[model samples]
Target: MEIKDKVIEIIAEQAVLEPSDVTMDSTLDELGIDSLGLVESIFAIEEAFDISVPFNANAPQESDFDISSVASIVAGIEKLVAEQKA
Candidate 1:
């Protein structure tokens, strides 16, 4: 699956929702995913893509990766994947 699709699936699993229920504009808050869920989702994303996410749970806003929205997270993961292959 594509990075976006896989990310959505992972996030959906964490939220106990279907992939169709998730959208690019969806935020973790909108999905009712707590901090622990967010961290778990990040870990899943990293493992799925075999890429390390530069996210800081304590200071998320200060991190290089953007987790503001599902689209942003997907974009960040795509970037990391591309960089890793380079």
Candidate 2:
């Protein structure tokens, strides 16, 4: 599957929502993903894609980190993938 698809799948699974319920612009907060859920989702994404997302002290809330929308999450995943490949 494509990056977007993979991202949506991961979010859907983590947020306990149907894949159709998530859109490219859907926010994680809007989907009711809490802090722990966000962490779990991030870890799952990292493991799934074999990438590590560096922790940033100034980054947005866990749920907000590139998770404001599916598109953003896909972009984050792409970046992580690139970093891992590098």
Candidate 3:
């Protein structure tokens, strides 16, 4: 699957919603995901992409990885995956 599609799928699963319900503009908070759910989603994404996310759940606002929106998260993951391949 493509990165954007996979990301939406994983995030939708975390939010207990259908993939079609998730959008690139949707934020985790907007999806009703709590901190724990956010962490779980990160883990799932990491495992799926085989790339570590530079996120600090305890200090989310200070983290290097962007989690402001699904599109930003997808971009970050795409960057990480590209770097890993390099």
The per-residue C-alpha lDDT of model 2 at residue 58 equals 49
Query: Model 3, stretches more than 4 Å misplaced?
Result: none
Query: How big is the positional error of residue 73 in model 2, measured in Å on the Cα after superposition?
Result: 1.4
Each prediction's TM-score versus the true structure: 0.96, 0.82, 0.95
Better candidate number, 1 or 2, judged by lDDT = 1
lDDT of candidate 3 over 25-71, digit per residue (tens): 99988999999999999999999999988888788888888898999
- What is each predicted model's overall lDDT from 0 to 1? 0.92, 0.79, 0.92
Candidate 2, 1-86: lDDT as tens digits: 88778888988998888999988888878988876777788888888888887644346655334666778878978987887799
- List model 1 lDDT by residue over 5-86, tens digit each: 9999999999999999999999999999999999999899888888888888889999999988999988999899999978
Summing lDDT over every window of 10 consecutive residues in candidate 2, give the lowest-scoring window. Answer: 56-65
Give the clashing residue pairs of candidate 3, or none. none
Clashing pairs in 1: none
Candidates 1 and 3 compared by TM-score, better number: 1
